[model samples]
Target: MSNFDYDLFVIGGGSGGVRAGRLAAELGAKVAIAEEYRVGGTCVIRGCVPKKLLVYGSRYSSAFADARNFGWTSDSLRFDWPTLIGNVRREVDRLNGVYTRTLEKAGVRIILDRAVLDDPHTVRLANGDAPISAKTILVATGGHPMIPKLPGSEHLISSNECFQLEELPASIAIVGAGYIGMEFASIFAGLGVQVTVIHRGDQVLRNFDADLRDGLAEAMRKRGIDIRINTETAGIEKVDGGYRVHFKRGDSLHAGLVMAATGRLPNTMGLGLDEAGVDLGWNGHVVVDEFSRSSVGNIYAVGDVTDRVNLTPVAIHEATAFAETVFNDQATPVDHMMIPTAVFSDPEIGTVGLSEESAREMGHVVDIYKIVFRPLRYTLAGRDEKMLMKLVVDMASDKVLGCHILGPDAAEIVQMAAIALKMGATKVQFDMTMALHPSAAEELVTLRHKWEAPTPMAGSDAAA
Candidate 1:
């Protein structure tokens, strides 16, 4: 019918690429997806899935400690790293197979080789096969961890290599305060490892609500985590049994492990996108329009590789929108606003919609309703942990603008909250909804008064 090796050729068999390939096939397009390493990409292979498993594994110590208050007993509690890591690896391998099979079942050919653009319509493979030409090309190559070029940085492990570590370190010094670094800090600390979080910024989680950032820092410190803010790393030098991490200001920290969770950059190196005339942003991400069409009409990209939002779900959403727009003849623009996100750190954090700062900066007269109270679960365990619930509302329209939660089940609670917020539910609607008794989430609907900062004591610095 047409002169092309396939209708669509997708590079990167990650979640977004897989979804696009599968949907395009269902819409009657011949598709072939290429992956160099594994089918599940970063999230399933090295990121969210494996990391969440480690978070669950690390949390057992707290559960074991709380069992006493719950009237349960274990004479001896021990954790085996090999067993947990082995099982996690097996699960990851199984998921990789599952993803591979899903594409096969969807009638999309899965190519297990590195692929790059030979031209706008041709895909060159690393296997030395003849180049395959497609009517359209989609890139969903995802991203990789970014590390600074410092002396002896080779000794530092990234978030990607954490799962594959042969053994957990006795102590770890994390070099960033992002969600990734903080999550690992919680994990290592929960598992009785000495964890020190070093950050150059004044606080952790820079773009998060200030209260939540400060609250999390205090909670982590109370758990014996040494959070060194305003500290800069000069370089790293190997020592006898560990590493001596040089500080910028004439000091050093010694630890069994040093990790750089600085940030992530799109995986766009040597893919030949730039030379092919597909536009890339200054950050080296593929610049695409609302429907994911790149500068070249037949080229499209979706996922972290495009750097819009950079979440796995957001990538999948973009991919679906791409398939809908290109294949189904329906014009769909990605709505990049009001995405719910979570940090699975100790105590956890979940937030959606605009932050209070964002709402205020956008010239909305806002009402900030907040409550911080110890959860009922902590009462019996004698764990003095507090749960935070805050709602930012637009006074003029009574529309709920933001929802933020910090504490246990924060991710789950905010997921349900996001649905209501997405539906444009108002503050009055939240109030009209009945509160579930004795639940942390009930506080969201029941909160009535605006929060006011406590006045400084007469002799305090603020008063002075």
Candidate 2:
């Protein structure tokens, strides 16, 4: 290994790559990380950080609207789009510098060029640049926004580009109903934009609990977002000042801007994975084992490139586990199950473990406990927003299989529930725990009645 130029070579200086590279270097291994883009990757540069900033900016609009109800009076309110965008860009740039400094402080060699695997142990940088060699190579190229191939798809902007818009559009038509799509919808709708969401699926968040799904849809609709479910975008054409979005549902909508939040694909293109013997999945995600090892014996992959969960925290966990496995000689594996996640959409959604539908599908007799009520804060503000909490339990084992929440601060509350679920807390254990009065989180442990019966398995394949 001493003869190799680097003990570990990381492609993509994203969350997982940076963590793995820095940790491996800290463990006395010669490490190098190559990134074609910014050091902080998607979460910092575009996805999480900027999105949250926009969400924060958009929330002020509602705050002002609801302020009058709370005895606070103000004249006409104004929002300067450039001011917010500039501030967010400055913050992102500062964070990017911080990530760079952190890597440098950890003695991880940082290369600012795209990397292509020349072989199992060698990677060639972009241009006719020199190739670097390492004993072990890790691919964490993350993912890119997947633009669907519609007739005039090129006319549509993506969520990535949407963040950098100079001026906020008066009306925006967002295509897709996933987290990203729904989040942008909430942001624009809150910001006084005439927002319309076109989703091909029957439900917005298909993976979340059904109760939360219905709750979020209702909340967004009440907020004045025109949500057209089971609708497909056929094409787009330039109209007067705005664009006409033709749909398969026999209707066309006009909007000043169109955003495509369809989904993201693994950023494996031009990486020379085939040339390096790394196998990719059907969706182009790099196939990796529990240990994050790719098909190439000396190479490994993690993060969005693997398309496993595709969350920043999951990537960080995998990176730490990768570091431990390689440098510390610990046989650690990333336990993806029970990974908690949150959507920052209005009336945010949070969940951990299995949904009732999924648990029953897995042959468990499940009992669902749920509650929906207006929070105490809304009473004072004269707002009608409702808080929803649910717990899915395996009846046979009495173990809490899942927890879901839809309300204000749902993310913060669900995180605590995630810890309990991680520790294998059962419904009885939750019941035994005392409730924190006047708190929405307490509902998780205080739900007394069984809300629904065991969901019958779909079709006649229950026995099979």
lDDT digits (tens) for residues 1-464 of candidate 2: 28789999999999999999999999999999999988999999998989999998988887787778789987867888899999999999999999999999999989999989888988898866777889999999999998889988888999889778998889999999989998999988888899999999998987888888888999999999999998999999888988999998678999999999899999998899988888999988999999999988889998999999999999999999999999999989989999999999997888899988889899999888877777776776777787778899999999999999998898988898899999999999999998777677777767778985634222211112
Candidate 1 local lDDT, 185-281, one digit each (tens):
9998998889999999999998888778988999999999999999999999999889999999999999999999899999999999988998899
TM-score winner: 1
Poorly placed runs, candidate 1 (over 4 Å): 455-464
lDDT of residue 41 for candidate 2: 95
Give the CA lDDT, 0 to 100, for residue 262 in model 2.
Answer: 90
Worst 10 residues of 1 by lDDT: 455-464
181: Cα error in model 1, Å = 0.7
What TM-score does each of the candidates earn?
Answer: 0.97, 0.96
